[model samples]
Target: MHEVLIVGGGTVGLSAAVFLAHHGVRSLVVEREPGPQVHPRATGVGSRTMEILREMGLADAVNAVAVDMKGISLGKVTVETLAGADFTTMSPSAQVYRDPDFTPARMRGTCPQNRLDGVLLGAARERGATVSYGTELVSFEQDDDGVTAVLAGAGGTRTVRARYLVAADGVRGAVRDALGIGLSGPGVLGPGINNVLFRADLRHVIGETRFAVCSVTTPEAPGTIVTIDGEKEWVFHTNADPAHARDVIRAAVGDPGLEVEIVSVLPWRVRAQIADRFSAGRVFLVGDAAHAVPPLGAFGMNTGVADAHNLAWKLAYVLRGEAGPALLSTYDEERRPVGALAMEQALLRLADPRLHWDNDPAMAAERARAGVVNAPVVQLGYRYGQAVQDLPSAEDVALDLDGSVGSRVPHMWVADGVSSLDLVESRFTVLAGAEDTAWASAGARLIDGWPYGPLLVRPDGFVAWRGTTPDDLPGVLSRLLHTA
Candidate 1:
């Protein structure tokens, strides 16, 4: 029997496998499709996701494959056509330019979904994860001990048993339906969008000036053009039919003579909803299976990656006998709220992409009073467990890290060319001041500050406790891990 079985081999599921492998836990990822999708789905990867990738030792690899669209892809630009005169650009909010000290990780980059998936799949396999494509989960049943699942594929049907099961099969997957889970929140947000992938050379027309997203408002075939490589590879999103794909591309580019080759057209819908629960019995849901949010802020994939990161370590500890089984329940308790919050934020962005960046003092003040925060806060400022109770009534627009419980530890330079974040490993670490000699024997990562107390940092890099005395350290650990 496998220790863990993951359904769906998209970015989120593959990320879960990689994270689990980083913790020395192996998993089997079953994807229905024979291979990764060629067309790009998501183009933006946030800072938090990059940090997690750094922790998994794939940061360099991802950077090599990702395109740096930082300054080039600033905001949305509306143009008459690719080679038109009239242009309207929406200035991005000041919140987009975050403080350099916000994190020790590198800046976020843009990589087509297929490229990112390849990176994750390579890393997961290298780290001892088994990924089987062309496989489908026919049925599954979970009990207290484990889960028994029947999977079908080209080979035939096979029964596999796993200690735990994760559903990453997407928004309309069968596992969630089999579990009888229901969705909550506003359903569909917008009209059906057709992703039209094509090859074209617009370099001569736009030259060095390139916008991240170009909204072509051509009368015949209005659509949005997203740069995949900032060159020939591009994706045009519209509600046009696939039969007239060439016409749509030509009209959007405003160049009837421009040679265009349509590659693929995929239809998708924008949705804002989350599962009523994230888990059932020993089975859990991750990514689109748990929450389906609009892609306005590119929060859907990022949130799913975060869900995998949050649950991977806890599952590792429990499987290793270091934490109690009850600790697993915290996966839902912690991730559900974050999923809901991401859904809410996605909807807000859908309605107004620059809602959090309102310049008016009165509007900003009202938004602040209502606890409206920007992307950084949603990405890095979120907390888990008992730490939620300590959140302020209104969150700041910047990333919040004060060594607080349930929050990620603040990034600080620990040694030459090494960040405090680099010191976090696959075990519970005590971040103590140099003066605190007690934790020295405990193999703590001693750093400045907290001379009056020590911080217990979990394997996932969240602060589990902050206290002055080490006398009750074991008790605190017991409570947090539910090992007692």
Candidate 2:
């Protein structure tokens, strides 16, 4: 039996497999599609997601092909006066906020979905994950010991058992449905249309601008214009009826529009939602299967990627006997709120019509300050709250150097030219203050019986329990490793 079976081979599934394999756990991926469908969906990869990819050793590949989005441009086009509309370009300002220390590592990169999937699939394969394409999980049954899944594919049908199952099967997940978990929020909003995967020769019209440009059309038709895959590709997202979407796009671009080639037109609706629960028995949900948000801040895919990373390490610990089953409960507790917050932010942006620029001097300054300047906090400054803890007061929890537990583990320049993230591979890090040498030693003894290596790591990079001390290590470790 496979150690774990991941349903779907998209970004979340592939990322989970890669992380599990890197930590010496075997996993299998079952995808309905034969290969990556580089749809124009989810084009931006956030910085934290890139850091996780770097840990998986796939960052270089992603960075090599990604388009660096320097900035954004907003223009106003009224149906009554479309001829002489003013367009304002907004660039990144010098005043930095939100994790300025990680500035060198904090930038969003864009790659087509296909290219992103290719890099992840390659990483998963290299880490010894068995990826079976065009395979559908027909059904599954779970027990205390393991899970049995019936899969249907080109060859026919087969039954495979696994220790655990993770459903990354997008929005319409059979596993989630089978578990009787109904979607628990407002349904998708107005019928929106996205003209994805299309090609156009508008290099001369839009010029060398690489980042996304938002064009505010008349109230009759509002949409976003973007370039994808180094081509003049436009994703026209309209709030109007899908039937009238084409006409709206034609009107926005005007006649003699630089040779527009229509490719695939995908109709979508915005939904802000999360599953009732993240786990039931041995089954767990991740990615779009667990929660979905409007695409305003590009949080949908980024949050899913974070879910995979957070759960991978916990699963590795439990499977390796390094931690007890109680550790698994932290998965939903830590990640569910994050998904909720992201959804709230996306909904707020969508409802705020002022986000669409009006080109007024005051409006432009407000948009620049709110949209561009304060974006990093929404993108990265989220912190874990009561979801992951049972403490009565926040002071009980040890804060990172940055005083934010939800903030990413601060990236430090460790020795050997490697990052603090680079140093945290295949082990649980225990970062303690210099005064806590005794606490560090106490932690090592608790991990002696555990399966994985015990890293009695310090707040800095000094090892407090590398066979140097033996005073009350077990008690300290137990306290540090205890869960609510």
Candidate 3:
């Protein structure tokens, strides 16, 4: 029997497998598709996701295959097209938005989804995760002991028992339906979009403006042009029909002479919704299976990877007898609110500038405060405070981490090219000022002398608890371990 059985092998499923294996827990990832999709939508990988991958020793491998779009103009020209635009007309950064105070070790990047899937699929197997493509989960039953899943593949149908299951099966996947889960929130954010994958040489028309996303505001084919390879491969996401998508691309680019070949046509919906519950007994929903966010902020897979990172360590501790089963409860509690908060942000972005959307006052006010888009704050600042308890800090603004219990530990530099985050990579770590000896004197591998005052850090790099007074240290540690 497998310890963890993951259904759906997209970025979410494969990433869940990788994170689980990084914690020394083996997992099996099953995908319904025969192989990688021809065109995947997500392009931007936030810095925080890059940080988590780095901790798993995957930064080099993933970065090796990624396109560094940082500090490059994302959109261009008279307004949106990539023609006759000056350098100043270009945008700030390509992928990771740089933050002065809390910048991580990695910058954001863009990689083709199919190539990224290939990277993750290879990396997961290297880390001892079994990834089976062309496999489908027919049905599953869960009791107190474990979950028995019936999976279908080319060979035959087989029953596999697993202690836990993660549903990365996407928004409309069968596992969520089989579990009888329902979504809550505004259903679809906008009209259905058609992703028209095509190969075209745009060097002549692109000119000096470089971008991963170029908005073509032409009345005929008004949509966004996503650069998949920064070269030949591109995806035009528009409302136009596939039969006329090629013509739309030509209109958007303003170059009818450019050679374009439509590779695949995929219909997608922009949705902002969260599952009523993130879990059912031993089964948990990760990625789109739990929440559906519009692509405006590129929070789709990034949020799901955050879900996997938060859950993997907790599952590891429970399975290793280091923590109680109660630890698993934190997954749903912590992730659901973050998921909802992210959905709100996505909705806000999608709701903006569109006369068709109904703008709630609160959302409008928040949007006004967050004037122009600042991607870093949205990516690095969200907390899973709900994991132990749902505590969204109303007074807390984005982009600042002030030693809060449910927030990411403030970053700092250490000697030997180590980061403050490196301390909590594999297990629970106690972080204190460099001079503080109380934790060390107690014979714990005290990560002596850090910025924060006696913070209990979880394996996932979030602060579990903190107390400067140092009273009831053991009790506080015990409580946090049990609760988290």
- Cα RMSD for candidates in order: 2.6, 6.8, 4.1
Per-model TM values vs. the true structure:
0.93, 0.79, 0.89
C-alpha-based local distance difference test score of model 1: 0.81
Which candidate leads in lDDT? 1
By lDDT, is 1 or 3 better?
1
Residue 469 in model 3: lDDT: 49
Cα lDDT of all candidates, in order? 0.81, 0.64, 0.75
Best by TM-score: 1
lDDT of 3 by residue, 302-388 (tens): 889889898898888888877888888889988888787667767766655321122333543454464422345556665665331
Rank ordering of all candidates by lDDT, starting from the highest: 1, 3, 2
Kindly list the per-residue Cα lDDT of model 1 for residues 282-343, writing each as its tens digit.
99999999999887667889999999999999889889999999988999998998888888
Candidate 2 or 1, higher lDDT: 1
- For model 2, residues 1-484, the per-residue Cα lDDT tens digits are 9999999999889988988887788899999988676665767677667767777777778877766554432222223212223233343222111224552254334666667888888888988999999999999999999999999999999999999999999887889999998777675876655554456664554455444444546554566655464445656665555455555655555533445556766667677788988888888899999999887767899889888877887788779876777767867887888787677667756765454323234554554444321234444555555332232222211232242333454455554556554554546455433444464544422322222133354221223233224454555445434532
With a 3 Å backbone cut-off (N, CA, C), the pairs that clash in candidate 1 are none
Alpha-carbon deviation at 128 in model 2, angstroms: 0.9
